[model samples]
Target chain A: MSVTAAKGFTAAGIAAGIKENGNPDLALVVNNGPRRAAAGVFTSNRVKAAPVLWSEQVLASGQVSAVVLNSGGANACTGPKGFQDTHATAEKAAEVLGRGAIEVAVCSTGLIGVLLPMDKLLPGVETAAAQLSEHGGEKAAIAIKTTDTVHKTAVAEGDGWTVGGMAKGAGMLAPGLATMLVVITTDADVDSAVLDEALRAATRVTFDRVDSDGCMSTNDTVLLLASGASGVTPEYGEFADAVKTVCADLARQLIGDAEGASKDIRIEVVGAATEDDAVEVGRSIARNNLLKCALHGEDPNWGRVLSAIGTTSAAFEPDQLNVAINGVWVCKNGGVGEDRDKVDMRYREVHIVADLAAGEATATIWTNDLTADYVHENSAYSS
Target chain B: MSVTAAKGFTAAGIAAGIKENGNPDLALVVNNGPRRAAAGVFTSNRVKAAPVLWSEQVLASGQVSAVVLNSGGANACTGPKGFQDTHATAEKAAEVLGRGAIEVAVCSTGLIGVLLPMDKLLPGVETAAAQLSEHGGEKAAIAIKTTDTVHKTAVAEGDGWTVGGMAKGAGMLAPGLATMLVVITTDADVDSAVLDEALRAATRVTFDRVDSDGCMSTNDTVLLLASGASGVTPEYGEFADAVKTVCADLARQLIGDAEGASKDIRIEVVGAATEDDAVEVGRSIARNNLLKCALHGEDPNWGRVLSAIGTTSAAFEPDQLNVAINGVWVCKNGGVGEDRDKVDMRYREVHIVADLAAGEATATIWTNDLTADYVHENSAYSS
Candidate 1:
């Protein structure tokens, strides 16, 4: 179950003839609820797609009756025409769902700088709306995939309420809202302000910490909708925790399905002077191509880890740093410690711990190893 | 004509058994002159190699009678022992050349965290010193190769004085003193301060702007030695220009021979509010993995370029940005412009011009496209 796992939500996925390959390319999710509260987080990139620009305005009303997403063309860099297409899409969704146009949020993915086939997409929206069902969450999840090999969805259950989310991203997966589209729906009694607070707090530690390729996308967006169909309002902290749990699960799935990755690496920075320091150090290691390649090759090259840390301005002395990879303390006091050959690398998951020895603050960032397949896949992605 | 193209300098290269492959791994360059003036630049990496730490101290004296460098093991992260090994290497070089230990600068490259075999290295210093000759410049350049496919050398001749240099690096190339070991010799009648100013100025635009793979090494070193043997003091501007020309030539060579690179990408950022803004934008593009991979596939994916520019803090309106690849303006006014199909990408050199439309400042950064070969080379390098 994805968004439809929650109460009073109907979802549908359909082929819109927009993808030349004849794949499912259109998805529609409508919140038929007693309460229509919504919040959204979009890509931090300044060059946003047309859908993001339109959805940003829609979210300001603190109400969303429906969300419509497409996977054949990202309405980005199409100038004024692209924005018009996105506006028209929202209008069509609003008309079909019998709601205000300003209450519809739009999301689009696939090739950048390409305009949507409005003739196919607009018709597909009506078809998707007609076929919408409470059990159509999986179909909606699958329809948003670009290069992803599998669909991703997560659910967190609370007292008489549930939160469900679906995400799609396979590349350009850096932080700052990540390069993905996500939709989370909850059947809980909440206002727009509470939904907004919970969504931001959940995404801050989950989606914002997953940096698979260090390339941010221009069309990333995450939306949360509350229907209040369950009528049971949980504690604010408990509700926020449930939302975070679903987001974290989805974020983990995103990293696991990152394009052409051979290993999923989790970098944990401990003893940082502050949480920001930990994040900065973690991102530095996550983005170091040399270290990523070494991780791919299963070589416990702690020197590269040190080199990456050295590039950061975090508070740490060279001799005070320590690194442990795969439970092996390969480097200690900024020098070789254990025999690197003793480190095991047969597993697909690698854990690296970098101790800054500066303070007690810590943070963890998830990323994937650099591989020839990653290079090959991205080299030919847009072709 | 490498370092020996200038007067009063002799060089030699020899196999020291440091590399298991039996490649030449030792080089020595001596300056027999009426003036011993030297200037040096090293990697900004905080975890510097032993040689960089040692050489940094040596250059502080503004005199260097001899220089020694070796490949096969970067004497970094060996703690006090690594520093001791570098000190011993310099002392051995000084003993062989009959100069003070403080007058000997050292450099080392290859895998980090490994201590050099001092027994073999010290003996090799004597062998290299005995074989030092004016004609050995090319041999010395050859000995410094690590992952480099070929040795690189550049020479610029003035009215009477000349500047010649050698560089070796095939990976881990980035800014803040690129990941390479370079040695330049000049016969101009200039003081250490003048040489320092000229070297820094030359490197700021040349070596410091070449960002191949964006992985800075801990052992980068560029040393300039002036013997004043020509007895001709060229104008400061003329001398600085000559130094910059040679450095630029070497930087281009490094990019051309970058490990597994199928394309050399030159990212020129113009219409910036300041030079810093231009450089920042240029570097952001150069370090973008998705754009590099797209370039490797010869795909004119200007959307990736716009996304990269959007990540920078440089002054620019998203709608005012423009990008041209190879001569075709694929993106203009932050939207699709000329037909991307009209862009040609059959050449190894790809030129990308990003017009920020913010101001008049401009900067260019050279980088290599990401490819499968690069992944393969770096993945198994340390193993």
Candidate 2:
């Protein structure tokens, strides 16, 4: 179950001819309920896509009826015309759903600096609106894929309430929001302020920590919509936890299916002075290209890890650092400790723990190994 | 002519067996002069190599007699034992050169977290000292090679003084000094204070601006030695310009010979509000992996350039950014401008010009294109 797994939600996926290969390229998700409450988070990148700009304004009103997303074009850096196309898309979606244009949110992903096919996209909006159903969540999840090898969806159940989400992203995934497009739905009695607080808190520790390649995208977005059809108010704490669970699950899926990645490396930074310090150290290690390549080669090279940490401003003396790969403490007190040969890395999943020996806080980041396939895929991506 | 192009310097390179493959791995350079003024710059990385720690102390007195460098191992993160080895190497050089240990400098490059073979290293220093010659600069340059395909050397001659230098680096090249080991010598009549001022000013614009792969090395070092053998007290401005020219030439060579790189990309950021902003923008573009890969594939993907800029805090509106790839204005006003098909990227050197349209300041950063061979070379480097 995806977005439609929650009560009072309808979704549809259809081929819009936007993708020249004839794949399903349009997805529509709607919340039909007693309450129309919504919250959204967008890419922090200064050069945002046209849809992201439009949707940010829509979320300002704290309510949304439907979300329309496409996979064939990003509609970014397309000049003023790009913003116009996004406005037209929301108008068309609102007209078909019998809602106001301001209530429709739009998202687009694919190559940047390209204009969407308006003729096909506008007509496909009507087709998707007519086919909307409660069981169309899986198809909707599949329709918003670019380089993704698999669809990502998650569901978290609570007392008399449920939260469901679908995500689409592969490459250009990095912090400040991974290059993703996600839509989440909930059937709980809640206001927009509560939804906003829950969504931000959940995403801050989940999707915000997944950095696949250290390349941020201009089209990243995450939206949460509440229908309030269950007629049962959930404890705010419990609702937020459920949202975090689903978001965390989707973040893991994004890392596992990262383009051209052969190994998914999890880096945990412990003993930091603060959570921010832990995150800073974790991100430094996650973005080190040399370390990622060594992970792909299955070589337990801990020196690169220390070098990467050295570049950061976190509070730690060089001699007070310790690192463990898999289960072996290969480096202790910043020197060689255990035999590197004993650190097995034959599995697809690799775990690394870095102890700063400075404090008690900790953080974890998920990333992928850099392989020849990664270079090949990205080198030929736009060509 | 390399370092020995200066009248008062003698150099030697030898196969000391520090490397298992039996390549030349040790080099010694001596300033036998009326003046022993020196200045040095080291890696800004917090986890410095033992040699960097040792040499920083030696240069504190602004006087040096000899420098001993090894290419087989970088004595970093080896704890007290690594620092002890660096001290012992300096003592050996001082003993052979009839100078104090406090006047001897040391440098090392290659794998980190490994101890040097003091057994072969100390004895090799004596042999190198005995074999030192005024014409051994070429051999000294060749001895410092780790993954470099060719030895890099440059010389600048004034009316009665001359400056010459040699550098060795391939990968793990980034700013905070470009992850390279360099030794420069001058026979001009200049004091240690003057040499320090000139060295820092020249490198701030040259070596520190070349970011090949965005990986900072723990063993980066650059030294400038002055011996008043020429007896020519030239103007300081003329002398500084000569030093900058030679450094710029060497920096270009390092980018051209970067490990596994197919293209040398020069990113020049113009129309910035400040010099620092220009440098920051240029460095950001230089370190962008997606942009580097696109250049390797000979594709003019300007959107990647904008995305990289978006991540920085540089001053510029989104719609005011313009990018030119190889003389083709593919992106203007943050949108598609000239036809991308008109661009031709057939040469080994790729030029990218980004105009922020904010002010007049500009800075250029040189980097290498990302390729599969870079991943392959680094993956098997430690193994």
**Candidate 2, position A212, lDDT:** 86
Query: Candidate 2: misplaced stretches above 4 Å?
Result: none
The 10-residue segment of model 2 chain B with minimum total lDDT is B374-383
Worst 10 residues of 2 chain A by lDDT: A374-383
lDDT for position A339 in model 2:
91
> Fraction of native contacts in model 1?
0.75
B1-383 per-residue lDDT for model 1 (tens digits) = 99999999999999999998999999999999978999999999998988999999999989999999999999988888999999999999988789999999999998888888888999999999999999999999999999899999999999999999999999889998788999999999899999999999999999999999888889999999999999999999999999999999999999999999999999999999999999999999999999899899889999999999988899999888999999999998999889999999999999999999999999999999998888888889882
Which pairs of residues collide in candidate 1?
Answer: none
**What's candidate 2's DockQ score?**
0.74
Q: What are the per-model numbers of colliding residue pairs?
A: 0, 0
Q: Which run of 10 residues does model 1 chain A get worst, by summed lDDT?
A: A374-383
Docking class of 1: medium
Candidate 1: stretches off by over 4 Å? none
Task: Provide the TM-score of chain B versus the true chain B for each model in turn.
Answer: 0.99, 0.99
